[model samples]
Structures are given as C-alpha cells and as structure tokens.
Target: MELEEIRVAVLRIEGTNCEDETVKAFRSLGVYAEAVHLKQFYSDMIKDEEQRSLFDFHCIVFPGGFSAGDYVRAGAIFSARVKSVLKRDLEEFIREGYPVLGICNGFQVLAELGALPGFDEDKPLADKPEMALGINESNRFECRPTFLRHENDGKCVFTKKIEKGKIVMFPVAHAEGRVIFPRGREEDYLERLKENDQIVFRYVDERGNYAGYPWNPNGSIYNIAGICNVKGNVFGLMPHPERVFWRYQHPNWLENPESPGDGRAVFESVIEYLRKF
Candidate 1:
C-alpha cells in the first residue's frame, strides 16, 4: 500500500488519554491516522456515518490510559468489553497480518485480551490470558524515562527499522505494568519467546545492561519491556512511544534536538512494512 492509502485506527474509549498523541505519531509520519472511539465501531446509538468496521483500517492501535477507570485490574474492563463485542474480528485481523499494537494501559488490555505471547499460531487469542501485568514491584506507579534495547531479530515488523540492540528512551507510566508469566512457568514462557524470536524489547539501564529496580522499573521477569504475537503482527509494550515522537517531547530536548525522536522508528518500521502490501 502507498503511504496515503494506509489508514490507521488509533482506538480509544472512555478514560483512554493518549489517543491524540497516538494519532499525532502516525499522522506525523504522513499516514492517514485518527482516533476512533471503541463505541464508534459497535454502538448503535452512533450515526451511520460515525460507525466503523474493523476492516476499514490497515492497522489498529490501543493507546495508553486508565480505561474504564482501571477499577477492574488495569485494562480488564476495556479488554472484556472489546472481546465481548469484537473478538472474532480482532482475531481475524491479527491472523491477516494487520498490525495491532497496545501500549501501557493498552498493553494491559492485550494481556487481558489474551493476544500477546500468542503461543498458538492457529489461535491468535488464547482461551485465557497467558500472562498478566500485575502491580509494579514498587507497589506504586513508576513514571519516567526508560531505556529499551530492541531485541527482535527482524521478526517483529514494528521494530524492523530499529537496529537490534539499539537503546531508545521511551517513558513508561503505570502502576500495574509488571509482566508476569504463569507461576512455575515463567522460565518456560521466556524460553519459548526467545526460541520463536518473539521477544521485541528488553528493559536496560543507560549503559545498555539489564538492571533491576528503577532501571527495570516494574521488575518484569527477564526485564521484558515488550513482545509480539506468534506471527509478529500484534505487539504490546508498557512504554509510551507516542509520548516521544518528536525531539521536543524528549526529556533532554534542548541537548538532543534531533528532528525525529527516539520513538519515531517504532512508527516508521510499521509504515515501512505496510508499504509492501
């Protein structure tokens, strides 16, 4: 698809706070991107022209924020509502190689939706979530710049433009962002992700070495910051890429006044991947 022909839907619903920035991230790349409310896809109260279908866009994104007030564990409420209304469509979308991304609260949603660590290629979403983003080991929200080392060996289309081992600063803000695998199966899941080349990013300190505490932030097992589905079509992470799409958005904007931000490559990689279709 040509750049203009590519349409991206940055999905949003009540309490989703980053749609505008997410939309700006893609729009800045010259793609047709917009923030579409989840209700706009299925709510009958919406006008005919306002309603949308999952197939209308080339990519789907679930941006960050406390959806539904995060009253129910993080993204639980939003994910449940999405599955109840559009499970099949979402599954088919991922199976078709359309990109689906969830960031931060959105990451929690995909985990709750059972779409990440997608072990079964035939089953895009497991019967139940295989992992969980539990409360931070700190027991409080950790909101600050994080160094992420891109680890995927070219399987993840979303990070292809990013060189392997490259470290980028993307800010993370969440209380329940710790990625925990099934108890007694943590090493097993990590091994599988490594074996399939599914791991996308790992948290590291400024020196590019895996560290704990504030550096690893949430104390996720293996310092995992992100991962993709079995087919590499769906991805989820806890950091906010859209929050640093421009140099001015960076923490050291005055000193690192580069044209594109550290996070720009995340969007660029996907756009580059879509240009072939």
Candidate 2:
C-alpha cells in the first residue's frame, strides 16, 4: 500500500477533544485521514452514506478524551460500548495486522478493552481486563511536557522510525494515567511484557535515566509510558503526539525551529510500515 492510499480513522465521541489534532497529524504526512464519530461506525440512526465499516480504513485511532464523562472509570464506558458494538470487527481488524492507536484516554480504553498487553492474538480481547491505568500518584491532572525514552527493539510498528534509546518529548494531560497491574502478578506481567518486547516507551529524566515523580509523571509501574500488543500493530500511549506534530508545538520550539517535532516520527513510522504492507 502507498502512503496516500492508506486511510486513517480517528475515532471520537463526546468529550474527545483531540480528534482534530490526531487527524492533522496523519494528514501532515499526506495520507487520507478523518475524525469519525463512533456512532457513525455502527449506529442505525446514522445515514447510510455516513455509516462506515471497520475495514474501510487501514488504521484506526482512538484519540484522547474524557469519554462518557469518565464517571465510572476512565475509558470504561467507551470500551464497554466498543465491546458491545464493534468487538468482532475490531478483533478481525487486529488479526489482519492493521494498525490501531490509542492516545491518552484512548490508551486507557485499549487497556480496558483488553487490547494492550494483548497476549492472545487468536483472542484479541480477554474476558476480563488484566491491567488498568489508574489515577496519577499526584492525584491531579498532570498536563506537562515529559521526556520518553524509546525502548522497543523494533517490535512496535508505530515507533520504528524512532531510534532506540532516543529521548523524545510529548505532553501528557490526564488524571488517570498510572499503569497498574494486579497484586502478586506484577512481576509475572512485567516479565511477559519484557519477554515479548511489548514494552515500547518508558518515562525518563532529561539525562535519559529512568526517574520517578515528575519525570515519571503518572508513576506507572516500571515507569512505562506506552506499550504495544504482541503482534506490534496495536499501540497505546499516555502522551499527545498529535499536539506536537510540528516543531513549534514544542515548549522549546525556539531551540530547534527548523526540524519536525519528536512526535512526527511516531506518525511516520506507521506510514513506513503501511507502505510495505
């Protein structure tokens, strides 16, 4: 497939504030991209022309937002709706090696949907969630630029363009971003994630050493900022890559105004992978 031939769907619902940015990020690469309301994909009330299928696009993106008001839990309602309406289609989509991206709250949804740390490819979603993105350790919405060190050893298709050990900055804004594992199985889960090369990014200080608190932002276990499925097609992270598609979007834009922002590589990596698919 060619870059221009690829289609990206940025899934959105009420409270999803980042769809425009996510769409723009893909369009910047000259690929066909648009924000599609979740209802448009399956709601019977939607006009026939507006209705869409999961396979219509090569990539599906769940942009950042406080879906369904986040009353029960971050992404709980949204993921439930997806499971009820689009579970089978989504499973087939992932099975075919198409890309699925979840940013910020979207990441929470993927975890809730059992798409992240997705162990069984034959069964894309688990009967129950194995992990969660809990509230930040600070107990406040942390919205600031943070550094991330790329750790994937070529397993994440969305991050292949980024060099290993390279540090990039992307802003995060969420109250519940901490990645938590159940008791007694933290080690087991961490080991499986590591052994499978599912771990993609880790929060780090300016010097690139793993750090805690402000550097780790949400204080996720292992300082994990992002992860991918075992197949490496599905990816989720707690940062807003679309917001930093351009160098000027960076807080230190003046320091390097001539180059693309750090987040661009993420979008580029997806294009690169699709070009060969």
Candidate 3:
C-alpha cells in the first residue's frame, strides 16, 4: 500500500472530531488519506464553479465524535445537515456502488440517514429509518477493546477480504450501541439478514463462541457489531475500529507478540474493495 495508490477523505463537521487518527491510519496503510472539513467542502462547492464535488473522493469516512453535541440524539442534527447539503450527491455515490462508512456516531448518522441496512437504494430518503442503533440494553457506555467476528459472507465490500469467524479487536464507546430492528419482528429480521448474508460482524468469544458479556458488551441483537446495505456498498458499525488503528493504540500490543493487527483489517478491507473497482 502506498499514498499514490489509495485515496480517501475523512469527512468532518463542526463538533465532530477524531479525523486526525483516521487519516493517520489510512496513511500508515500507504493510502493517501486526508481529513476534509465538511464545511470547507460545502464552501468550495458554493465559491468555486469549477470545483469538483465531495463525491469526487474514492471513499468517504464519517468519524466518531459528538457531532452537533449529539443534539436530538447521537447524530440527528449532523445527519440532517448532511441530508440538506449533500443529499443528491450522496445518493448518486451510493447508487454508483462507491463505499461509504460511518463509525460509532457516524453509524448513528447513517442509521438516521436511512443508509445502513439500506432497504431501498432507489427510494428517496425517509423521515424515519426502519432500523436503528438504539440505546445499549446495558444502559451505560462501555469503552473497551472488544472482538468482533465476521459472521456473514455476502454483505459489506469491507468484510469480503476478511475471513469468516475472524476476530478483529476494536473499541466500543457509546451509551447507545444496541442494534434494533423494528418491533416484534426480531427473529424475522435476523433470519432475513442472516439468509441474505448481511450479518457482517458480531461480538464473539476468543474461541468463537457467542457467549460472555465481555464478548457481547452491549447486548446488541445477535451480538451484532456492524452490518451493511443490501448492495454491500454502505457499511456502518458501532465499534470504533478507526480508534485502534495503530499498534500502540492497543493496550497490550507490546506485551503480546501474538497480537496481530486488529484495527488494520478494516482499512485493508476497504482498500481491497476499492481495488476491485
């Protein structure tokens, strides 16, 4: 991987931070990625007639943070602003099968934007999304490194390069990290997503068992850490994979030689997906 070969842009807005480490993660992987303030892009679009749109980027990243100070919810205000400004371009980008990833707070935005597990890509954005990442059943924000197992093979261009049952360590820090499908239809929703192979990632014990609270930190339905749109182009996850991108970011890296690159898989997965295009 080299800067000249890979191109990505970290999307940031007022009150939404954490793009710096995200840029470093991609750059470290030899991907020439940079943090682009959403306001700057919006301003450029308004000031320069010849300027290309934000959709020009290969991949767009919505990092984690308190966007709009989590007003109305974790990402409600931010998602609304994005919809108002970049709605058309964003839709076109998704339609073209380009990748868009939202991590933690970003995931909340995507869910609010009707982009994750996106049911109808052709339909206009809805007032309320059918699915949501609700408050954790635990009723507390748990900030700790946890492992997620890749459970499905078909969904998510990001997970296509990862091995089934592969355990990747990442941090989960959110008061509301639970994945909720519409009411009473829990089993049906899980069965449908599973059959479609859309259950992209899930919490799992070291031996791959779906047991223990340490593994299933927030009690997300089916221990889900993430999922993708039907087209596998739009991905969203509650855990902050982007947070642990460096070796030192892991608490026990130096003490454990067997510690493989936990956070690297995510960036690598995105790169591999883009290479196919």
Candidate 4:
C-alpha cells in the first residue's frame, strides 16, 4: 500500500479541468500520480527535456472537462494535438499493454481520435468523427448521481476486479453524453464486443427501482456508460468517478467511512492491475 507503488500520469490541457480530482483519487490509493500539462508535449522549445514517455506510466488519464472548449467538436483540438505530438509514444504505450482511461470529455477525445472500437482500425465514416457523442436524447445537459452495472463479458484491465452486475455510483455531466454507433450495425458491434468482452460499464438504476429513461440519464446505446478496447487496456467512459473518491464525495453514505461505497474502487482497480505489471 505504499504511495509510490503505482505510477499514473494525469494529463492537463486547455479546457481539461479534472486533473486535481483524478490526482487525489489515485493518491488516496497510495499511487504516485503526476499532473502533466499538455503544453509540455506540444512544445518544441524545451531543448533538454525530461518528460517521461507514456510507457513509463502504468496508467494515463485524460480526465473530464471540455477540452479545447468543445469547439469544432468536443475533444477535436486537443485530440489533434495529441495525435500530432504524442502519437508515436502513445501507440507504443498501447502496444505495451498499459491502461489508458479517458473520462467525460476525455471519452470524447478517445472517440474522436479513433482510439475506441469500430474506429480503431481506421477513420470513422464521413460526417462522423470516428465515433459520435452527440447531444443527449434529452437535449439537455444532465448532471446527477448515477449508477453503472458491470457487464460480465467485460474483462478490461480497468474493470476486471469489479464483480459482474455490480452497481457502482458516480455522476455524469454532459450534454453530448449519448453514444452513437453505426446504424443497423449495432448488434454486430455489440456481438463483437461481447465475443471480445469489451463492454465495461453500463448505466443502471442506482435505486434498483427503474430500468430506463431517468435511470439511464442519457440514452446511450446499449446503456453503455463506458467501454474498452479489444485488448482490454484502453478505457473511455462518460461518468466522473474521480469526483467521488471519498465517502463525503458520495451523494449518500454520511456516517460510514468504511462503507466501501464510493468511487475509490475505480482507482484501486487500476492499482491492482498495475501490480501485475
């Protein structure tokens, strides 16, 4: 449980505002988390550089917020910057079997960058930015505490320790939280995901009282709140798990610090996964 056991890099860039919470979340698990600004990589002026390679970190996080102001599309600018500057190192990291997580706006970034499935092999079809995260079916930005049910087929490194059908609470805040896959190819993609066990997390009724609409918050395809790559190394999701790292951060659980009901499991899962590497 040493603080220096796990190494995590929390990327910070313009419009990327969730670094502190992400850092704190990992720090609580006694992991070494560093907040690295995107400017550090996008810069060409620093001659004697000591920046660590993406491979050096066991987990790399693209936390929430409207990266690049969500202009020209969410995560477009920052994604392009990453593709241009960190492409080689990032791809190497992926090939090396490390965990990469993109949360909220970060999820949008991964999709736009063709880092997720359906778009991983090539660019998405015309008019689509690899994957589409469009306006919520509700047409409004919903910010509420939510729950996600773990899928059994999901064996991703990030969610490996979470039991099947286990429901965890986290909050999602986004206007374009609805996930869109190719039309008429939904089942095919899902089957492929199932065969590969790629589906990681799904929105569910936290109270276990309802099964649709408000319980889902956003109308994501297949109730998907998050997913992983075929290799189970890269993960991208819409909810802000880092925001609920502590018991007080939870919407409930006021009198129980050891309830084990907050979002700490997400970080601990990463810690556990890193232990093997």
Task: Please give the clash total of every predicted structure, in order.
Answer: 1, 0, 1, 1
Cα lDDT over the full model 4:
0.78
Off by over 4 Å in 4: 1-5, 47-50, 118-129, 207-210
Q: After superposition, how far is residue 89 of candidate 3 from its true place, in Å?
A: 0.6
Per-residue lDDT tens digits for candidate 1, residues 154-249, read: 988899999998999999999998999999998899999999999999999999999998999999999999999889988999999888889998
For residues 99-167, write the lDDT of model 3, one tens digit per residue: 888888888889888887676768535567767777777777888888888886856887776788778
TM-score of 3: 0.90
TM-score for each of the candidates: 0.98, 0.98, 0.90, 0.90
TM-score of 1: 0.98
Give the candidate order by descending lDDT. 2, 1, 3, 4
lDDT of 1 at 1: 91
List per-prediction Cα lDDT, in the order shown. Answer: 0.92, 0.93, 0.79, 0.78
Could you give me the TM-score of model 2 versus the true structure?
Answer: 0.98
- Candidate 4 per-residue lDDT, tens place, 56-158, comes to 5778899899888899988888788888888777777777777888999989888887778632423221223545788888888999888888785546887
Candidate 1: clashing pairs of residues: 1-277
